[model samples]
Target chain A: MLARDDQPTPPLKRTPLHALHVARGGKMVPFAGYDMPVQFATGVLKEHLHTRAAAGLFDVSHMGQIVLRPKSGTLADAAGALERLVPQDILALAPHRQRYAQFTNDQGGILDDLMVSNFADHLFLVVNAACKAEDEAHLRAALSDTCEIEVLADRALLALQGPQAEAVLSRFCAEAASLRFMDSKPLPVMGLDCFVSRSGYTGEDGFEISVPASAAEQLATALLDQAEVLPIGLGARDSLRLEAGLCLYGHDIDTSTTPVEASLAWSIQKSRRHGGARPGGFAGAEVILDQLDHGAPRSRVGLKPEGRAPVREGAQLYAEADAADPIGQVSSGGFGPSVGGPVAMGYLPAAIAARGGVVFAEVRGQRLPMKIGSPTFVSPSYQR
Target chain B: MTTLFTPDHEWIRVEGDIATIGVTDYAQSQLGDVVFVELPKIGRQLKKAEAAAVVESVKAASDVYAPITGEVLEVNETLQTDPAQVNTDAGGAAWFFKLKIADKAELEGLMDEAAYAAHTA
Candidate 1:
């Protein structure tokens, strides 16, 4: 049945820990079709700073989880089949290791960015919440013949991140402290079976635990009981990721922006590029490889606004204050609590995308000056 | 001295012809944390309901409208450096600006403390 204009809007979905969030004074707001907490009673500023200093618990259960198992009983078969959709060296991924990848369209644009972890005999993928349905359809349509795509709907993802992450997590899962950055494995966390990954969107050292939906509240409650851990909401999550230079699926990297232009060429390994083994088989390989070799026409760069006023997303960028034509636009911008200033990311013509270059951003009918710099506003604290 | 509030969540403390303006405590709680504040220039003429100042939180920026027609007489310069004060003391020390009321008749349109409380409730 077709939806009518007079039909009432569908109600938002709630996570397993929704009740606990409300009990802790979380301010609930609609986000990605889920009724999620934007911040707790302590507020976003304190939550953001707390995550940087101590540990913070984040409910990322809204993201999609999928498993790709090879029908031929070989991990390479599934990795090879999956290579057709992404631009990463999936076959080279070691067992219990995770890597960042992006699903590219035929036009060299990003469909979605995801995390691919190599399990014992299968690949576990974590895709964005907004693009999960389309991603599942794309995977089934293309790789169903060689692999089995299982969508795990009965799971919840929680991120415990910060300097005290290892100290706090080790209390329940002692093996957690042993896994270095990018390591993934099935571990018993708080006596529950879970897929644990030593990776997160925030620059701080952390672990993302994938637990069963039924036991999510139990696990979250036990973790929050720690003195170092506090319930951080979506507001701090956005600012933390932004300060860490991680791209939000729809905002920083979208269908209109390629990985090369988005300054994510580092994620594209040499094995997937020209003259390497198994090169140019994925979608948009020709255009992506061309951008890789000759460089893209425009490049994404970090912006530091000179004033206290934040230069937010969609703010037009200009090279001159009086310029009639705009140069580019900010894709993601906001106040960074750790940096104690405003940080932004936007694309600029490659000719003028040099570090330390000055650009003007139009905010509230006023042209504010900003300096171009490295996108990683804060240094990463990953344990190798 | 008379205190009044507008539907937009701004509170004005009137003493003689000078009126001090700031956002209510409820507004500060909803806005979360105040990271920055942009005030109007002194001597600028503002019409009632006109966008006069800007209050920025970490997530978004909100416009503080003029509660009544007046000329900007002074602004809270302290907010430029320490905007967090708006969160700590929104009703008292975090006054946004002082306006020389151009027309005392505009005060009649504002709600008293009791009406504003009921309106917010």
Candidate 2:
């Protein structure tokens, strides 16, 4: 089998957990400018299944973590500053709570999607690794006068996700057990001060811990030492998130797509929309609110293939079996280990993107029948 | 019977006029997990180096090329249900298809086990 698209990448950067990954027989590949493991000896299928059945430890240090602190020393200052960049209710966010938000451009196009956490002193943000540099530059240029955009270059991030995650994590850090979904706190882990958040990209229940770069290996080892926790790689991470109906940075949501088109309008809280007390202060607020009221032309939807064949990314979507007209294209797709079939997500015309609708995908010159289903193929197991 | 390997990592075992073709262990390992295999139809004629089948893994899809000129005689239908068979026993039960050898002269262009091992190494 000849696999294509192995482009010559530039020199890749290694994470703090690089040595441990190599020692554990990880098959490292270049991703987001980092030398990261795509899978280990167990392979992608088993790893994806293992994460759903038990707990899986993922080294996501390649993601960008930044701390936003207002120079005035008031927490509201940082929140107010960030509110200008995203369309989320940042100022109204309760302390120690986290909310998902996206960095949108003036045209209502998504620059990047991120998680914002309200801390006791400042706002903490975690962004996609590929867009971190551009995100950093945007934050500095926009919010520099209000808050200090400090990139946590000395930090490493790890995600332990699954049903058994809480049981395995609460043993090491007592403060972690009390955290509900979207809750975060700084806890002592393996002699290091790490910020632990009860959230993850996977639809499963999990925690994302931010530890110092120097102590990342020790912390990962401690978590993996638990019987329920296994080291997962980027491959399983993608499949899991895809099955969960989560969007990847470059693939699903990008600068060309607005929040409404990407089916992320639910993320925009009612408190920030039109008719709310505080309205239209952030970038793209006007266009986004208009789309929210009028509706988007196209929307993202999940696809279940009628046959075993997977309708991969870039596959054209047709409204009918024999019609040559293309309606959409598959964005993210693969064999979902949990779904037990070929599952895919893509943007379809808003009229036909609803559940139970049929859309044919052109694969290998054949129009394969598919069913438009719920945006999420697998029910999220988040511990709310 | 004798087995030969191709630079593309396919293996074929020839016995009389029929030759069974499948991917090598190294190819399977490199491909990681096999989720779907689109086998060639029986009675289809194919030239050497032409695309014969497609293998879909969790990450991407790959094309399995024909190693020799032949007429497809049979296919491993088991792969449609259990593609993981290719990962477990690729050279044996997971053989993708059987071909009626149309040109034995093409065998001289392929590599033997030692040459394949050195080439892969």
The best candidate in terms of DockQ: 2
Model 1: interface root-mean-square deviation in Å: 10.1
lDDT of 1 at A374: 82
Binned by DockQ into CAPRI classes (incorrect, acceptable, medium, high), candidate 2 is medium
**CAPRI rating of model 1:** acceptable
Model 1 scores what on Cα lDDT?
0.93
Q: Write the per-residue lDDT of candidate 1 for residues B1-121, one digit (tens) a residue.
A: 8789998889999999999999999888778889999999999999999999999999899889999999999999999999999999999999999999999999999999999899879
Candidate 2 ranges beyond 4 A from true positions: A4-8
Model 1 lDDT per residue over A290-369, tens place? 99999998989999998889999999999988888899999899999999999999989988796457999999999999
lDDT of 2 by residue, A1-384 (tens): 565567777999999999999999999999999999999888999999999999999999999999999999999999999999999999999989999999999999999999999888999999999999999999999999999899999999999999999899888887777889999777787658899999998899999999999989998998989989889999999999999999998998998889989999999888888888777798888889898888888898899999999888899999999996899999998889898889999999888885457999998888998899875988998877
